[model samples]
Target: MTRILIVGGGYVGMNVALRLQRRLRHHAEITILDADSYMTYQPFLPEAAAGNLEPRHLVVPLRQVLHRCRMLNGWVVGVDSERRTVRFRPHQGEGYDLPYDLLVYAPGSVSRLLPVPGLAECGIGFKTVEEAIHLRNHVLAQLDLASSTRDEAIRRRALTFVFVGAGFAGVEALAELEDMAKDACRYFPAVDAADMRWILVEATGRILPEVGPEMGAWTLEQLRRRGIDVRLDTRVRSAENGRVVLDDGDEFDTDTLVWTAGVRPHPLVRATDLPRDDKDRVKVTPHLTVVGRPEVFAAGDSAAVPDLTRPGELCAPNAQHAVRQARTIADNIVARLRGRPLREYRHAYAGSVASLGLHKGVAQVYGVKLRGPLAWLTHRSYHLTRIPTVNRKVRVLVDWTLALFFPRDIVSLGALAEPRKEFEFAAGAPDGAKTGTQDGTETTVPRPAGARF
Candidate 1:
């Protein structure tokens, strides 16, 4: 049997593997290797972070989905394509090399970080589930601190939130969190929505570049109208020492610094001996085949797949392209198995959709522009159709339906970060067993610096 090895569990790899399993069953053995057991539906990450949807619903377990295929929870360290061998380290296992007949490399991107001083130590990226959860917890905790604090400096710093990106991820993240914070403020007697400072610093001239320039301008206006400090043509000089200093010489003290700048191809790509583009993405032909290597295939954020629809343009690293490419590749793989000719990939540009918070959005679909609540509905409806899995789809839809009746859930379960804190404290209870932190261990989500009672 031909042993086919697939890497990465993102939209491209997982989608392709699942489809290929049904088509090429009894002909080939499909094995998938990924660092995470679950594939995150990144489109729903903003809603997940905003507490609009449960985090569990946004991720599909690879084992459950890829039932027929063998699953390996591991990291692909390097790929020796010439030798047809994969060197990887499985979770809690010794590093080993696995030989394969065909390879599907779909390793996705990582946070594109710059060499900014103190950024590595202080800044947080809004990419993964963990980061989203941490951000939600941290934001709420900051609110708690601001509300309970008597110190003016601490209160000011606690309320100031800064995000350094204006792309889809950054905008949605900031918007959703802002909406949640605004709603959550009602519960805090001392906290007002106005007290919170939301600063969106973009080095570029505008936000939401994926959307047209007109829509982008409208987004900027909407943001400013909603009281967000939209700093355009401004770059971050330093975020060192809780000081958010910009290129324009403006500085502010903020406790929260979110770095959603962008993402680059996976670091593992660099470690492998593959011909890469100037952007470090694997150079793949229009068929999503790595140059000079017919057996090896790649797609998604890791590969620079030529866009046949737009001359001289590479396919954008988006969910739409990733899913479509995976399906095309899967079909082509079956064709190859049957000694049929391969097909070229091509797709016209689809419009973009963005949610600007609860009941607010902007979208341009098939040349039809929509704004406000209508656009928001389209955004939700479009994504609901594409988020994958009947179970997840039902769950997500239910969440949205429930939101109409009940207000947004803004209560932060900050203890989720330090689950053992209470247990650890119980083990070291004092003579009187006071309900207070005995240890000086600072948690990732620090509470208000005042009396609880």
Candidate 2:
């Protein structure tokens, strides 16, 4: 049996595994290597952050979905395509080499962080389920702190939320969270909706470039109508010590800073002995095969796939392309194994849908525009079909159904991030002190000084 090694169990990786398992079955041995055991449906992240849907429901367990394929929880540190060996490093173990007859490189993209000051320390990225949940807890915690604090400066800072980047992630995340925060204020007597400051800073002149300028402008108008300070054609010069300094000579203190600035190809791509384009993405033909390497295939955000619909353009690194590319990848891989003619991936760009809080959204599909409740419903209905697994789909639908009756869950479980802190202090174990395990192994786990949120 042929050993097929797949890197990054994300949208492309997980889907490819699922398709291959059904197609190739016992004919080939498939192994997926990923940092996380679950695949996150990123479209639902904003809703998850807003407590509209449970974060746990947004992720599909790789092991559960890809039962036939072997699952390895690790990061691909390096890949030697010439040797057909991949170097993988687990969360708590040493590195190892894995040999494979065929390679599927779909490690996905990481947050494309700029060299802005204090960003690494202060800003949070909205990508994974963990980040989404953390952001929700953190945002709610900020509201809690602001309501309780008597200091005007601290209260002001805590209530002020600043989101950088006006892409789908940034805009939707801010919109949903803002709506949740505003609704949450009804319970806090000390805080009002007007007291809190919500600001959106975009480097580009437009927002939601996926939905076109008209919809983007309309979104801008809608956001501005909601009293959100939408600053266009501006950049974040610095975010030092919770103080945000913008290029347009404006500065403000904010306890919350979300950086959804966009993404770059995962560093693992650069570490591979693969043909990379100028953008550092694996150069691939329309068949999803890596350039000059028949045994190696790449797709999703990591592959610079040529756009057949448009001449001289690469497919945009988005979920729309990634999910469809997955189908072609699986088909091509099976064809390669069976000595059959492989099919080329050719799909025209489908328009985008963006939810702006409950009962409000904007969508552009096949040049047909939709807004308000219709668009919001479209956004939910579209993602509902895409998130994977009937179990997850039903659960998410139930969540939305429940939301129509009950209020949104605004409780902050920030302490969950540092569950051991209180216990360690109670046990009289000093911060960074070594603790003995059941097998008499000593490990030093550093106790957090306080809640970072």
Candidate 3:
């Protein structure tokens, strides 16, 4: 039996494994390696951050979804394409080499970071579920601190939120966070909506550059109407010590700084011996096969697939293109195994849609422009149909249904970070000294001279 190895189980890896299972009858053992056991639906991240959707519902468990395929939760550290061996670093143990007859390289992208000072310490990227959940919890905690503080400067800083970048991830995350934080103010008697400050600093001249200029202008107007400060043609120079310094000479103190600038392909591309483009993307033909290597296939954010329909253009790295490319790659791979001619992937660019907040959005679908509640409904409907798994769809639909009656789940369960915190507190450590829980999972953090948690 042939052994096929699929690396990085994101949208591409998951789709390839499932499609190959049905298409190929060559009796191959398919194994998938990924850092996380679940695949995250990134479009729902903003809603998850704003407490509109539960974070858990955004992830599809690989073991449950791909029960027939062997799923391994580990990191693919390096790939020796020439030797047909992949170096995998297991999550809980030593690293090992896995040899395969055919390799599907689909590891995706990572947060594209810049060399701005203090960014590593202060900035949070809006890329993962952990970051989204932390943003929600940290924002709610900030409100709690602001309401409890008597000092004006500290209160002002705590209530201030700054987001750098104006693309979909940045804009959607900022808008959703601002909406949720403002709505959460109702619960804090001491906190007023007026005290909150939401600022969006865009390096470009306009936000949502994917949408046309007119739509971008309209989005700017809508954000301005919501009292959000939109700084255009601006750059965030430094975020040192909670102080945001901009190129326009404007500076402000903000507790939260979200950096959603963009993403670059994952480093695994360079780790392999396969040929890559100047942009560090795996160079693949129009059929999703790595150039000059028939046994190796690539797709999704990590692969630079030439746009056959449009000259001098590469496929944009987005969910729309990623899913289609994954499906095409799977089909082409099966064709290669069965000695059939490969099919070329040629897709036309579709319009984009984005949500501002609840009951508000902008959409340009098939040359038709829409805004307000209708656009918002369209945005939800489109993503609802695209997100994988009927189990997740039903769970998310239930979450949406529950939201119509009860209020949003704004309460921040900060203790979720340290699940054993309450257990530690209840263990009765005399004089707050070091002590262990009954389960032996507690770690004692000695209190500094006058420090507070």
Candidate 4:
């Protein structure tokens, strides 16, 4: 039996593993090695951050979905194509080398962070489920801080939110979060929606470039109408101590700084000897097979698969292409094993869809444009159909239905971050006096000046 080892449990790796496991059952030995046991449905991340959907529902368990395939939880440190061995380091214990006959190297992308001062210490990325939920809790916690604080400077800083990047992730996250925060203001008597400063700083000329320029302009207009400061052709120079200074000479203090600039291929790609493009993405042919390495397959954000639809261009690193490319890669892998001709991976650019908030969005599908509530419905309906597993679909639908009848849950479970605090206090400091300060006053921990989660 052939040994098929998949390096990542992301969109491409998971889908490819799922397909190959079913198609080559009892014929081939399949395995998946990933840092996490779950695959995040990234499209729903913004909603998850906005409290429109539960964070748990945005992720699918790899073990549950890929039961037939061996699940190995570890980080892919390096890949040796010549030796056909992958170096992996698990959560604990020593690192090991796993050999394979066929390699599916699709170790997706990571946040593309620049060397901006204080960014590493202050900024947060909006890629994973943890970040999404944490951001939600953090945003609400800021509202709490703003409403309770009497200091004008602290109140202003707490109420100010800044986001860099105008892509789908940045735009949708900012929009959904702003909407949730505005709605949540009603509950906080001291904080009003107008008091909150929602700033979107994009280095580019426009936002939502995935959708056509017209739709992008429309979305920009909609955002501005909501009092969102859409700063175009502006970049962040520094975010030192939560004091944001823009390239356009504007400076402001904000507690929340979200960096959704974009993502680059996983570092593992460069760690390998595999042929890569200038972008560090593994170079693949139309068949989704690595260049001159027929036994090796690649897809998703990590693979620089040639876009047959547009000559001289590579497929855009998005879910629309990733999911489709997985099918082709899987079929070709099976075909190679069965001594059949491989199929070329070809897909036309299916339009784009984006949600500004609940009942607000923009979409352009196959030359047809849509906006407002209709586009929002279209966005939800499309993603609902695409999100893997019937179980997750039902849960997401139920959440949306509940939203129609009830208000969005604005409660911040900030304590989730420090769940062990109380337990540690109880265990280590049994006596109340021991937990107090030298003056016998209860030690009051200072609240974090910025987002903690």
Model 2 spans > 4 angstroms off: 429-453
Local distance difference test scores for all models:
0.87, 0.92, 0.88, 0.92
Candidate 4 residues lying further than 4 Å off, grouped into runs, are 427-429, 433-453
In the predicted model 2, the residue pairs found to clash are none
Per-residue alpha-carbon lDDT of model 2 for 1-453, expressed as tens digits?
Answer: 999999989889999999999999899999999988999999999999999998889999999989999999878899898899999998897999999999999999999999999999999999888898999999899888988989999999999999999999999999999999999999999999999899999998999999999999999999999999999999999999989999999999998999999899998888888999887899999899999998998999989999999989999999999989999999988888878999989999889999999999999999999999999999999999998999999999999999999999888999898888876665676444667889989887565535332
Candidate 3: tens digits of C-alpha lDDT, residues 145-247:
8998899999999999999889999999998888888889899999998889899998888899878888989999999999999999998898889898999
Error of 2 at 234 (Å): 0.2
Q: How much does each candidate deviate from the true structure in C-alpha RMSD?
A: 3.5, 5.5, 4.6, 2.5
**Model 2 TM-score, 2 decimals:** 0.94
* TM-score: model 4 vs. ground truth: 0.96
Minimum summed lDDT over a 10-residue window in model 1 is located at 444-453
TM-scores of the models, in the order given: 0.94, 0.94, 0.93, 0.96
Model 3 spans with C-alpha error above 4 angstroms: 420-429, 432-453
Candidate 1 deviation (Cα RMSD): 3.5
Cα shift from native, residue 432, model 3 (Å): 4.7
lDDT per residue (tens digit) for residues 1-453 in model 1: 889898998999899998999888889999998999889988788888888888898888999988889999888999898899999898796999989987889999999888877788889998888889889988998988888889999999999999999999999999989988998999998988999999999989999998888899999999999899999999898888889889999999998999989999999998788899899999988877889888888899999999998899999998899999999888877777788987888988798899888888989988888889999999999999998789889999898889889987767677777777665654555332444455965333333232122
Candidate 4 accuracy as lDDT: 0.92
2 or 3, greater by TM-score = 2
Cα misplacement distance, residue 127 of candidate 2 (Å): 0.7
